[model samples]
Structures are given as structure tokens and as C-alpha cells.
Target: MPRIALIGGNARPITTAHELGVDVVLVHEEGRYEPDFADYCSRILHAPIGDSAAILEVLRPLHAEQPFDAVLSATEYAAIAAGEVADALGVPGTTARTARALKDKAETRRLLDEHDLSPIRHAMVASEQETADFAESVGGRIVVKPADGVASLHVHVVESREDAATAFKQLREAGYTRAIAEEYLEGPVVSVDTFSHRGRHVVFGMSEYQMNDRFVEWEVSTPSRVAAPHRAELTELVGRLLDVVGLTDGPAHSEFVLTPTGPKVLESHDRFAGSGAPELVRRACGVDLYRMFLAVQLGFEELPQTSPVNDHGAAIRFFTPQPGTLKEITGLDTVDALVLTVPPGEAKGNIVPLLSRTREAEVVVVITRHPGDTLPELRSVKDCSSGYVIATGKDADEATAICERVVDQICFHVE
Candidate 1:
């Protein structure tokens, strides 16, 4: 068996790694921690994020003592560091420059600007004054976020100068040296998953991502049901971006906006899509993205072709309770797939649970092949019921309706 070193071995990709029959080395302990199964080769290396020196200290001895074939990264930060390690260890990985550019929001914006691919006006701010000035210059609403982070942490849209200043102060205090403030593009957010090998790029699939009113991501559905003609244009834009960024290989997750003007690149990751997105893509289109990523890391030239397996649609909905103890959960029967964050009893407030902390809620995913899948129209609410429902369909309208219904059935309790 080929020995492979996996960084950031969390539950999301562990199952796929097990199925691939490769050695697994977990880099982070944020999720469930455990030893490898007796049948599979696995180990836990105690190295946390932001401590690249320690990771090297531990892996250096192992590289000298054992013969590992390749090193793969399962997280954004880890992947950025792995690129540097791969250079030193003579292994295949993303270039450190590319990784850094992808990981840092400010750097990404600069690159896009240089390539003339940036569709919206953007600025990097280090202080409240700078944020206000940029917001004024842009003239429209602005979206602000940490220069480098994931999961939309500290992401907020500022409708006024006051909001911009407050957001900047909070982010600066949180140790984010700078934040990117860009024009808030109006339209649906879409996630495009793709893989590249030796300059050959393939778009695994595209999904329309839905978010709650508060800007928390809800779910993702394939063959984006927003508009039909936007698919090809989005794919071409992604390909052009890959070429511009000089991203030659590995798995990539790119998020963009299907605005009235055109597709605007929100950001891109040189790693596999997170949030069980890889699995969702696999179900919608018969592509094992995780497996393909491993192949690229190992210098494979081609990936297996895949087609949609089922005509029916699939979706995953996330759930969060009101600002109180998570007493219980109900109404799961309306969905097909589910994952929970808070157990039956736990204190929950504001749904701003830290990613490094415990899982605060669960996800209920749904899939159906029913023809003309029509869901009851839903009225958007303010609190209690907060989350996203990911759905796919044969056409955009069918998928949109299912998503609306899934959103409606979700209800929450807090006291």
C-alpha cells in the first residue's frame, strides 16, 4: 500500500481517506479525535495551526525515520503550510506563493485586480478611517472579512459608515491585521468545485449556495437553480482564473457571485470544498473529489470521468437554535440527510459558536428524485429558525422551490 501523509485529518475527509486505503495523519484536533482502525494505516500527529515550526519539528523526524510517499492537506491553513514543507521535503504540493495568495483575502483581491478579473471595487483596510474611506469611495454597501480565515468567520456586510467602523474595530481586535472591504454584489452565491493536474483542469461540479438572512451559509445544491445560462459562463470564468493564478494542480473550491453584470470571484481555495461539499458533489455528479485530489497529489495525470448518477436532487440543511439552551430538536422527517451540532441539551446563543469549539448544531440533508419537485412558499423569519437547505434538481426552478420549502419546515426553540 502507498503511504500518504494527510494534514488536518478531521471527520469530513477521514471516511474518504479510509476508502482510498492510504495512511492518515491528522493535523488538527478540532473535531472527533481517534486512532486509526486496525485495518487501515492511521496515526495522530499533535501539531496545531499557526505553529508551523512545531509541525516541522514533529514531521522532520518522521520523514527521516519513515518512508512516506506524498503529503496532502485537508484544510486551508494546513495546505498553505504544506506547500512550503513539500518544497523542503521534495514532495508534490501547491507552491507556497500560490497557497499564500489563496489563503489571504487581501492578497487574492490584489491578484484578481492585477489580472483585471475583479468585478467589484475592493480595498484593504487596517483601521476604521480606512474602512470608512473605502466604503465612501465604493458608494454602495460593502462586505468586510478578515484578510485570512475561513468559514466566513467575522464576515459582515456594512450598509453604512458606522457599521464599517464597528466591523473594522472588532476584526482588528480579533488579531486580523487587515480586512478586505469590497462592493456587495447582489445575487446568488455559487460554489464551483474543480481539480487540476499538470496544467489540465476539470470542473467537478457547480452548486448554488444559499445563506440565511443573517449571512450564515445554509446549504448548497447542484446545477444551480438560479439561472440556466449562467453555468457555462461561470465555468469559463473559473478556468480563466485558474490560468491567471497559475494554479496547475490539486483540488480547488471557488466561490463567486452571479451578479447582473457577470460572475464575480468572491474567493478561491486550493483545497477541497469544506462542509461535506465534496460528498454532495459526488452524489450530484459521480465524481469522488477526495479520491481525485489524492491522485493529483501523487502525480496522476488524469481523473476518471463522471456523470450525474441520479436525476433526483440532493440537499443538506444546517440548523441553529435561538439564544438559549438547546433543549431538543424536531421536524427532521422533512429532510433526507442530517448532522447535528448541539446535542439534545446544550447552551446556545447567537449561533456564533467558534469553529474550534464543540459542534453547536446539526445538519439535516435531504435528497429526492420526485418529478416537478414543488415546495410550499416560505416566509422569511428573523430568529429561532436559522440555517440553510441545500437542494439539487433537473432544472433551476425545481431546485429553487425545494430549497424554499426546506427553509420553511425548519423551526427552532430557545428559552
Candidate 2:
């Protein structure tokens, strides 16, 4: 079996790696390993995935002894470091320079500006004053987010200089030293998932999302509803991104907004789109992106074209509820479309939890309240979730309808 070096401790990739019959030597931080991951891995090297020096120190000796066939990572925290390691080991993967630029939003914007890949105007700000100035310059309406944000955390739309300054302070307090403020663009956002090999990008799939009141992605429908002409346009744009970012291999989840002017990239991640997206891809197209990532790293000279597996639409919906302590949760096991569900007890319980910038609380005083373990209040996407529900149907509308039935049945009695 070919030995592979996988950076990070995400269990999904580990389980898939095992299925591929590859010996996985996981390089991860201390205490980052999932309990079940050990069963699939051949060896575990505990070190911070971000520490290139430490990772190299461990992998250098191992490579000299047995030699790893490939080095790769599926997690954002480990992608850059994984690339650096691959470069040091003389393996094929994304270059360390490319990985670094793609990981930081500010850096990505700068490169896009330099390359004329996007028309979106943006600036990086480290202080409230800088944020206020940028917002003013952008007609007093802008989107502010952490320079290195992931999973859409701390992404906010500020309509005024005051809001921008406030957002800036909140981000700084949250440990984000630098942030990006860009002219707010109004449009529908679609994701283009692709696989790149030797500077060639192949479109894998596209997904569109439905955001909750708080702007958290509550539902994602795959095989996006984008028309054929626009789909081709988006594909070409993603190809340009791949070239500019220097991602020669592996998967990319590139998001773009369909602005009236044209389609422009919001941001792109050099990894598989999370939230059960790989499963959606498998159902829509006969492509296993997880397997592809591994195969490429393991030195597959050419990847075969995948035919459509089924003519259907797939959707994943996350549970969002009103904030309060949980009195009881029902219909946990009843949903047929349920793909992942974490118990209420296992999830967090909170009353009047701090909402994200986009979400607002509707005050209603209740006469009676049920007493039970506290349920986590819904705030951002990172907040404790009841888990996700996945459904497949003949079309996007049908898939969403199935998801609605599951969502309606799952109830949380919050006080």
C-alpha cells in the first residue's frame, strides 16, 4: 500500500482514506485526533498543523526512512502547512506560496485586484478608523469580515460608518487583528466546486444556499439552478481563479455572486465544500471528490471522466431554532431524510444568546416555561447545531420540499 501523509484531524477524510486502502500517517495537533480516526490511520504524529517547522521536523525523518507517496490536507487549518510539507518532500500538491495567498481573504483580494480577476473593490483595515474610512469611501455600505475568516464567521454587512466601526471593534475583540471591508454587492451567491490537475480545472458541481434570518446557511441545494450559459461563465471564472491562485491539484470550493454587472467571486477555499457536500456531489454526479483528492495525491497520472449518476437534486438543511433552554426536543429519530442529527442534550442550550450582526431578537414574554437542560441559542453557523438533514429529489424544488417536511417535524421546546 502507498503511504500518504494527511495533515489535519478531520474524520470524514480519514474514513474515506481508509476506504481507499491507503496507509495514512496523520500529522495533527496534540489532542486533535477523533476517537474513531485512530482505527483508520496507520500512524499519528501529534503536532500543530500550522507549525510548518514542527511538521517538517517530524515528516523529514519519516520521508527519509520510508518515503510518503503524497502529502495532502482537506482542512483549512492544515492546507497551507500541508502544501509546504509537500513542497519540502518533493511531492505533488499546491505550492506553499499559493496556499498562503488563498488562505487569507485580504491577500486573495489583493491578488485578484492585481490580476484584474474581479471588479470588487476592497481594502484591509486594522482599526475602527480605517474601517469607517473604507465604509465611507464605499458609499457607507460595506461588508466587513476577518481577513482569515472561515465558515463565514464574523462576516457582517454594515450600512453606516458607525456600524462598520462597531463591527471592527467586535472583530478585534474576537482576536481578529486585521479585517477586510469591501463594497457590498447585492446578488445571488453560487458555489463552483472543481478539481484542478496540472493547471487544468474541471468543474465538479455547483451549490446554492438559503440563509436563515441571521444569515447563517440553513440549507444548501446542490447542482445549482444557474442556467447553462451562466454555468459555463462561472466555470471559466473559476478556471481563472485556479490559475491565479496557483492551485495545481485537489479540490476547490469557489463562491461567486451573480451581480447585475456579472458574476464575481466572493471567496474561494482550497478544499472540499463542507456540510455533507461530498455526499451531494456523489448523488448528483458519479464523482467521489474525497476519493479524487486522495488519488491525485497518490500520483494518479490521469483522472477519468465521471458520468452523471442520477438526474436528481440534493439538499442539506441545518437546524435553526429560537434561543432558550430546551424543555424537550421531539421527532429526533422520525425524519426519514435525516442524515445527521445531534441530540439536544449533546448540543448547547442558551437563552437570549448573543446574535450575529445580521440576526435580531423578537421579544415575547412567555407565561410558563419548561425546565430542562439548557439548549444552545442559535447565533452563528458555528453555534451548536441539532445537526444537518439531507434529502434528494427529482429536482431542487422537490428536494427542498422533502427538507421542509423534516424541518417541520423536528421541534425544540425552548423557554
Candidate 3:
């Protein structure tokens, strides 16, 4: 069997690779080991966190001993490492330039603007003053975020210089010295999942998001209700954006907001969509995106034609609670039967630790909340999530109804 070097274990890419009769060698950061991977992974390699040099040192010997067919990563943070390893080994995968652009928001925006694919104005600012100036220049309202982040962490919407200054300060204090101030574009957010082989684009799915006040996604529904024409337009636009960013092979996630003018690219990454989206796509299209990504990288020329597996809708709703001491929760049995559910992935406890206090904490609170726990102080997504509710229905409305039913039936009591 051919071997693939997987750079992260955050998703079920290992299981997918294994099921496809491919061997996955799991490489992850030290102290972040996942025992679940042992069953599917052939070997486990570790390197210092955020140290690509150390990761390369680790992969070199492994490659020499047993040549890898491809280097793969399904996580945003590890995409660059995957690219570097692939380049060194002359394998099929993302290029170093594309991976770097995906990791740096400032670079992505600049590239998009240069290509005339993105109309929004943005700047990478170092200090609160610079952020304030950019906000003023962009008509007072701006979006501020760390130059490097994932899953909406440390992102802020600012309407005034004060908001910009405050957001910039919080970002710096959080150890991110550089931040991007962007023109706040308003619209519904959606994710476009695409596959490319040597620059040939194939768009398979688009998922719509319901976001909270802080712009954190609260719920996600796949096979977006976007009209056919608009969907086609979005498909064309995203394909061009991928080419602009130089994505040559494998899977990529590109998020966009449909503005009054048209669909504008928000951000793009070379990975499968996070937040339970793989299951969503599977429920909608019957496509194992993780597996397909690996197969394409391993040089599969003709893939199985993809189409909707069902007309029914699939949705994921997060369980977010107010800040208070945990008391009890109910409705597990009732909520569990609603649909195929991926459990809200944490254990319940007496006092849920608040993850962070920044603006991100508000959305992050709900982002991380579990289904059946009491959170005394809801801080960030990391500490407050109790669980998530996944549902499938005959249509989008029906799917939403199932999710809503889960919400209505499940109860969290805190004091």
C-alpha cells in the first residue's frame, strides 16, 4: 500500500485515508497526541508546535526510510508544513507560495486585490493608532482581525476608531502583534468546497452559515439555499479566486459573503471546512471529501462523479449557554434521536472555565458550548461548548426545524 504523510490529526482524514487502502503516517505537535489515531495511523511523529523546521527534520528520515506517495494536511495551521514537505519530496500537493498566502490574511487580501477579484480595502496594521487611521480611511466601519487566525478567532467588527483601537489592543495583548483592518462588508456568509488537480477546478459543495452578533458561526447548513444562477456565479468566481491564489491540487475551503454588488471572497484555506462540515457535505453529496482530497493528491485522474445523495437538508447547531454556575442539563435521549449527531465533544463539569474575555469570547462562548453542561462563566469557544446538534430533513426548512426542535427540547440550567 502507498503511504501518505498527514501533517495533522484534527479531522478524520486519517480514517478516510485508511479506509481508502492507503497508509497514513500521522505527524502532530508535541503534547497534543490523539490516541484515536492509533487504530488508523501507521506511525506517529511529533515536532515542536509551530516549528516547521522541527517538523521537516522529523519527516526527512521517515521519507528516506519509506517514500511517501503524498503529503497531506486537513488543518489550516499545518497546511504550510504539508506544502513544504511535499515540495521537498517532489510530491503532488499545495505549493509553498499558496500555503503561505492561505496562512496570512494580509497577503491573501493583497493578492486578491491585485487580481481585481476582491473589491474590499484592507491593510495590515501594527498598532492601535494605525488601526484607527485605517478605520477612518475606510468610512469608520471596519473589520479587525489578527493577520493569522482560524475559525473566526480574534475577529472583530468595528464601527468607530475607538472600536478599532480597542480591537487592535486586544489582538496585540493576545500575542498577535500584526492585525488586518478591512472594510466591513455585509452579507450572508457561505463556504465553497473545491477540488483541483494541477489547476483544474471542481466545485462540489457550498455551505451557508448563521452567525451571531460577533460574526462567529452559530449554525451551518450545506447545499446552500442560494438560487441556481447565483450559485453558478459563485462557483465561477471562487474558481478564479483559487487560481489567483495559485491552488494547484487537493481540496480547498473558500468562504465568501454575498454582498449587494456580488459575492465577495472573505477568506480561503487549503483544507477541508472545519466545524463538522465534512459530515454535512457527506449528508448532502455522498462524497467523502477527505478521501477525495487524498486520492487526488496521490494522482487519481478520474474521480467518481459527484451528485446530491438526497434532497433533504443537513444542519449543525451549537449549544451555547449564558455565563453562570452549572446545575444540570436534560433532553439527551430526545435530542439524540433527531438526526445523525456528532456529540458536543466535551465532558460536563460543575464549573466551566471561561476560555477568553475578548470580543471573541462572546461568540466563542457559544462556539464552544456543549449540549448538556452548566457553564458558570462562558468565556470562549474552547471552554463553553457543551455539544452540537446535527440533523437531516427532507428540505432546508425541515432540517432547520429538526435543529430547532433539538434546541427547544434540550435544556441547560445554570445558576
| Per-model lDDT | 0.63, 0.72, 0.70
Comparing 1 and 2 on lDDT, the stronger one: 2
Q: Rank the candidates by TM-score, best first.
A: 2, 3, 1
Q: Could you estimate the TM-score for every candidate?
A: 0.80, 0.87, 0.87
For candidate 1, the clash count comes to: 14
User: Which model is ahead, 1 or 3, in terms of lDDT?
Assistant: 3
lDDT of predicted model 3: 0.70
Model 3 agreement with the true structure over 320-374: per-residue lDDT tens digits: 6666765666665554452222234432220121211111211111223433444
lDDT of 1 by residue, 1-415 (tens): 5566666644435555676665665555443343332234466666775466766776777788775687677678586777776667776667777888888877887777788885568888888888888888888788888878676667877878789778887887878878888889988888888888777677777777666655656555665666347877877788877776778888889998878887789899888765556655655665667677765566443564433343444454444434444433355565543533433112121221122121122224322111122221122222323334545555444655665666566554333
Query: Where does candidate 3 stray beyond 4 Å?
Result: 30-33, 227-229, 304-310, 336-384
Candidate 3, poorest ten consecutive residues by summed lDDT: 350-359
* Candidate 2 structure lDDT: 0.72
Leading candidate by lDDT: 2
Off by over 4 Å in 2: 30-33, 227-229, 305-310, 337-374
